[model samples]
Target: MKKLVLTGAAGRLGSYLREPLTKMCDELVSTDRVDDIGTLYPGESYVQADLSSLDAMLEVIKGADMVVHFGAIGDEAPWDDILQSNIIGAYNVWEAAYRCGVKRVVYASSVHAVGMHLKTDTIGLDAPHRPDTYYGLAKCFCEDLASLYWDKRGVESVCMRIFSCAQATNARSIGTWLSYDDLIHLVERSIDSPVVGFTVVYGISNNDRAVVDNSKAGHLGYRPKDNAEVFAKAVFADTPPLDNKDLANLCIGGPFATVELGNSGVAALGVVDDRKET
Candidate 1:
């Protein structure tokens, strides 16, 4: 590809993706609201942009072959915030991509988009949206927007509904964890694949106890190499036993599944201060 643009360049996942993404394109344009980004890959350049403003987004994606959109307030924020970042920002990306003639969009969608679904039932790419929070609702809106762009304007999209993608701290992560190495592989396949009109794949590893189903969108050739199961023994032993009566514990979204709309589940988890250095 001539150019690849990544939206959430300062994010933890985005930081990890920079080196690999830089190698895939002659120019890798990384953008975020934050002003500082520590080291950069040889071909990578940083751009400061906002999600809500179409002009800002368009300016960053002007000369790109494809876009990897990971920008936005990642956790559950206020309704207005979600409206601007997740909703409006998502539209700006697709619209700008269409107007600028970008071929494909690789999105960082979330499992919270379908978090309210029961864990017992294995959901696929086509599952109906049961967003656990306003944040999740934004994901649903973008997925639909991707579909609309594909059907109407011929711009392709790939929405990967990621599960828990962090350090494996608890048992829930064992089923939802998506390792950094596996994540790099997934994005590579999404970019190099021959053609994909509009597809949704679970952003998860090949774990022994994965809860989500990915068979419906297996054509992308995303074969994850990591597994969270190895950490299960230590994680489960150190944590408290499961609370069967709690809807938050049993549901697929975990705390997100039961938290009231507009509430912050991330706060309850306490301070997560780790920032990826470039």
Candidate 2:
């Protein structure tokens, strides 16, 4: 690719992506609303922009070949916050991609998009949307937006429904954990895939207890290199006894599965960083 644009550059995932993204293209333009995001790599540059503003997004995306859009209120928040950051922000990303002649958008969708589904049921990429919270609902909307962009506007997209891209700390993470290396690899595959009109794949490693089926997206060749099973013994040893009645334990989205529509499951569970700092 000639140029690649990444939103949410100040974010944790964004920091991990900076070097790899820069190596993938001639120029990597990273942006976020924050004033700065620490130091930068040789081939990477930063921009300050809001996701809700189409004009700002368009300007940042100008002359880019593809966009990796991860900018949004990443946690479950009040309806107003979710509406502006996730909903409107997603719209701005897609619409701006279309207007700027960008080829594809790689979104950081979440498992919350279908969290209400029972963990016992092994669902595929085509599972119906059953968002656990407003944050999840926003992901659902973006998936639909990706579909619309493909069906009507000819732009392509790949929505990676990330399970849990963090350190293994509990029983749930044994099945849902997506290692940092795997996360970078997933993003790379999403961008480099030969043809992905509008695909959705679980952003998970080869975990033994993983619940979601990613076979439908097999055509994209997203072969995960890490496995959460390696950490199972240590994780289970440290994990507290499971509370069967807890929505978090029973729901597929884990913490999100049990959270209220406007609550913050991410915060409640404590910080799980992918190491955004330089």
Candidate 3:
């Protein structure tokens, strides 16, 4: 690709993706609301932009072959905050992509979009939306928005409903983990795939205890290599017995399914800040 744009460049996941994305395209434009994202990769440039502004999004996404949109609040928040950063932000991204004539959008969706479902039931790409929080509702909105753009404006999109992208620190992560290596692979597949009009795929690793199916997205060729089972012994040993009645323990969304309407769910997961430095 001649040019690729990545949003949320200052985030932990974005930090890891920056260097690798620079290698995929001649020019990788990374954007975030922050002033700076430390150092830049060899073929990369940084742009400070807010996702809520359509003009700013257009400027960052213009002249791009594809957009890897990972920008958002990343957690449950007040309705107003979610409205601006997630719901409206998603509209801006897709609208800007449509206007810019970008070929595809690789969105970072989340499992919380269907978090209210039972963990025991192995769901697939066709599962209905059962958002667990305002944050999750944002993901559901984006997935539908991606679909709308594809059908109405010919703007392709791949919405990856990512599970736990952090370390397998708890029992829930044992079945929901998506390692860093696997994440890069998924993004690569979404970008390189030749003919994805609008697709949804579960962002999970090759674990023995995975709770979601990705057979529908086989065309993307996303084959995760890492497994959370490796951390099973330690996590199980350190953790207490599970409560079958607890929504957090029984639901696919884990802490998110049980969190208050606008409260943060990630705080209970104990994800460490391990952003890769440039």
> Alpha carbon lDDT of residue 214, candidate 1?
93
lDDT of 3 by residue, 198-246 (tens): 9999999999999988898999999999999999999999998989999
Residue 103 error for model 3, in Å? Answer: 0.5
**lDDT value, residue 275 of candidate 2:** 77
lDDT of 1: 0.88
Cα-based lDDT at residue 226, candidate 1: 91
Candidate 3 residue pairs that clash: none
lDDT of 2: 0.89
Candidate 3: stretches off by over 4 Å:
none
Question: What are the per-residue Cα lDDT tens digits for candidate 1 across 45-107?
Answer: 888889899999889999899999999988888899999899999999999999999999999
The numbered model that scores best in TM-score is 3
User: What TM-score would every model get versus the actual structure?
Assistant: 0.97, 0.97, 0.99
Comparison by lDDT, 2 against 3, better one? 3
Error of 1 at 172 (Å): 0.9
**CA shift at 220, candidate 2, in angstroms?**
1.2
Per-residue error for 162 in candidate 3, Å, reads 0.6
The residue-by-residue lDDT of candidate 2 on 1-278, one tens digit each, is 88999998888877889899999999999999999888889888899999989899989999999999988988899999999999999999999999999999999999999998877788888789999999999999999999999999999999999988878777888888888899999999999998999999999998888888998898888889887888888978888898888878877888888776788888766656757667
User: Where does model 1 exceed 4 Å of error?
Assistant: 269-275
- State each model's CA lDDT, in order: 0.88, 0.89, 0.94
Candidate 3 overall lDDT versus native: 0.94
